[model samples]
Target: MSGSPALFDAHLHLRDARILPFHARYVKDALDVGVTACIDCATRPEEWAMEVSSSLAATTAYGLHPWYASVSVPNWLERLECVLASDPNAPVGEIGLDGIRRVHDGGTAQRAVLFAQLDLAARLGRPVILHGARVWPLLLRLLEPWADRICAWQLHGINFSHELLALPFFKRANAWFSVGGGLLKPAARLLPELLPHLPLNRLLVETDSPDRFPIGGDPLVLGQHQLLYNQPGNLRCILRAAATLRALPVDELAEQTAQNARDFLAAR
Candidate 1:
């Protein structure tokens, strides 16, 4: 990793309960491989507190993910606002619409929670890390109104759509697209096509670790369960794949995307 450019994992979940016990090893492994920083996207209130209190050397994002929408505490919104208010640099997310899963009200609860979080992001002028699965059109429609108010946002683990890049958010340069292990899948077709179209300055890379384990990815061994989990150290592999897909030098793409992550986190 000596000659490799330092990498930033724009999205991950270091505070996740399953990974929390092995966080130290996870961070060390990533650092040893040149992944110096990351954005910890906490999907629930407890994870948010953990991220804020931990010494992970990464930017922290606080939000309520769609999966936990119905189960979230009544004061979750207030708690989220307090966390964001406490750290101005912190973004609001790992939040958005998920069409595939069945939640409390057949998606109605998910929409309501998403709208609240979006409104909060808009009011605070915070950047957001978004997740939309099988519902890009609906997510885009819901996001359109708040696009002008929120300073910046990233679509994490996004699937490709021709209309995606054409949105006002992209045109205004307020949006970013993050890709991860999904790129390593031999069956992945849309992302490869989406890569060339993404602006270098607006592109980002992430692991979304503990999930979406890249095909052929180097797995982090979890001793207790003997489970293979993705870790930030694997960022280098994702970067290499992205560079090849975009026809850019690995170092060049690495440097640019690292800077992109910085700019996005620092965006007002």
Candidate 2:
């Protein structure tokens, strides 16, 4: 990997308990394979500190995921603010509406949490890492007001239609889209169509480690067996998939997306 361009895993969750024990292994593999950076996204309050601390070679983001919206913990917002304030440059994110899963109060609580984080991100002039599954339309609508205020934003693992690009907020400068390993699957829905429509400069790649594992391979096994665990090193596979879609050399795509990540993170 000496001559290969270093890669970036635009989104992942290093603080996940299942992955924690293997954290050092993941980092070693990522670095060994030329993965230079990543964004470790925290989904809740308890994981925030560890998320930041564990990202020794990557950027860190802390946010209240929509699934945890109904949590009745005291001073969560205040604590979140304290963490964001601790590192003004770190992103605010992994926050957005999720319509697919059942949550308390039919997503009302989720909306409240999402909106509050959006407001906070806007107020702090921080870039955001957003997650939208079955709620892209609502997410776009909710982000309308901060279209101008927010410094930058990345929609992680977005598999939406071309219509998303037409949204006012998406049209704004500094909007980004991260392509994950999911696109590598033969049955990928909107990615094949969506990738061709997106500007390469605004595109990024991520493994969403320990989550959206690519189709048809055991990431944890290389021999005859299979182990279905995603890791930061898997970013190489995603970069290859994206390179095929963009019709560029893998090294070229890696360089472009690396620069894109730098620019996106600098938005804060």
Candidate 3:
């Protein structure tokens, strides 16, 4: 694909591409949003085959996520290694710790599994599309050794606090922030501070289609009440909000971010 400044969604989940209508609608929503490429992140190990087989994008990140943590996760790690070794093109990701929710198995095993993928990515030389919840510290700690090895690392779905960005761990890492409908949350007003520091190339846009939604409560909005029913197409609102915060024209930022994503995948 030629490098066009069209919008690019760096993250998304396509569910199961084998399902016909799901794939059709997912692709339609992405196109409607001008998304040039969407990274479908898979958490379940058994879902990797579906993810790989289903992804229409030339580039994608494949790995087990903490959400599917179990005693068998380690074995899936081996399976992931096999896929990566054979293809060696897919970025290693959708892998990280989520300590905030129902992680009944605890993080010790999760960390071990996460680090193993990190090590594999480093040795093989590829970028990583990450998932970090309250586990930012541990995420950074696990990533420390592999920082230089990363082509580009993205923190999916957050406008992180300065403290996390200020830490020494991120000093060597190239950080990309993904903002979507979730930004509509009152807490997401933080974008004004977050967008300025991140440059165009480092900036990435994503719909996380049929999956991404703002952290805001579903209340009837004032001007556009239709938005109360959030959908993937609403990513346009996210780009508009982000552009306003950065003080740049929406079209310009959209093009730049799209290019940024294409360049990111190229690096791999």
Candidate 4:
């Protein structure tokens, strides 16, 4: 965290040529720019190994995400167990409930799958990076018992305003919010209000990459609404934006967030 320091994108998705060509270039760009690390999220058993294989220097999480909500519980669990048995080092995560998205999942199914992953992680004594949307309340309810079991919990791609971050559970729990390109929106300045609501020690930055960007680099300021893309390289801009919002030096902002990521990883 001294000198130029390093940027660790807590969450990202980069598909290889065998899987998809678009993300290969994106991954190269991130590595070329010296991103410290990115956690490649696996959304299904078929894609779990790809997530682990895609990590050139970053890490990976094995489990089915919200999109596979309709995917039967036993099917995904078998795949998760296979990945775990093969790679005991791989963590189980990027799994949770989502009410905001149009995933073909039932509320009960989402809860069931998420709980199963948590149980698996607990047995393995590994950590997790959660993805909870409108179902935050439900997520907390299920995760309460295992609060100390997870290594980390990340709320991905959120545009949360200042007032919505007032949950007391977050203060007592072990989790962090991974803010993505949502901060690039025109009303981004409202982010300052969000900083005060959390434990302050538990905050992280991410691009969520390809999906968050979709288009290409457009800039977080004037072009926030230009439909620009998101990437690991853009995380620096996110750091800068956060620094400005908090009225702190850029280096300090980067250092603090880096520590937060470390703490999240180590706490598990």
The candidate scoring highest on TM-score is: 1
Residue 256 CA error for candidate 4 (Å)? 2.7
Instruction: Report the number of the highest-lDDT candidate.
Output: 1
Clashing pairs in 1: none
Estimate the TM-score for candidate 1: 0.93
- Candidate 3 on 39-66: residue-level lDDT in tens? 6665566666663343345365687777
Provide C-alpha RMSD values for all models, in order. Answer: 1.9, 2.2, 4.8, 4.7
TM-score of each prediction: 0.93, 0.93, 0.82, 0.80
Task: Give the per-residue lDDT of model 2 (tens digit) for 1-268.
Answer: 7988888889988888876766676677778788878888888888886633443467889999887889887888999999999977789989988877887587889888888888888888899898998788777877788787888989888888887788888666478889998788888878888998998889999888888778743375434745577887788878878888789999999999999999999876
lDDT of 4 by residue, 1-268 (tens): 2467667787776542232544554556566655667777766766775633443456666777876767655566877888878866566768888876675435777778888888988887777778776666556666677776665566665555555454555555566777766666665554556765656577788877656662224322222343244567777777776677777787777777877867766655
Q: Give each model's clash number.
A: 0, 0, 3, 4
Better of 3 and 4 by TM-score: 3
Summarize candidate 1's per-residue lDDT along 152-177 as a digit string, tens digits.
98899987665577866565548889
CA lDDT for candidate 3: 0.66
Please give the TM-score that candidate 4 achieves against the real structure: 0.80
Please identify model 2 stretches exceeding 4 Å from their true place.
51-56, 221-227
Of 1 and 3, the candidate ahead on TM-score is 1
Regions of candidate 4 where Cα sits further than 4 Å from its true position: 1-3, 16-19, 51-56, 103-106, 158-168, 188-192, 214-229
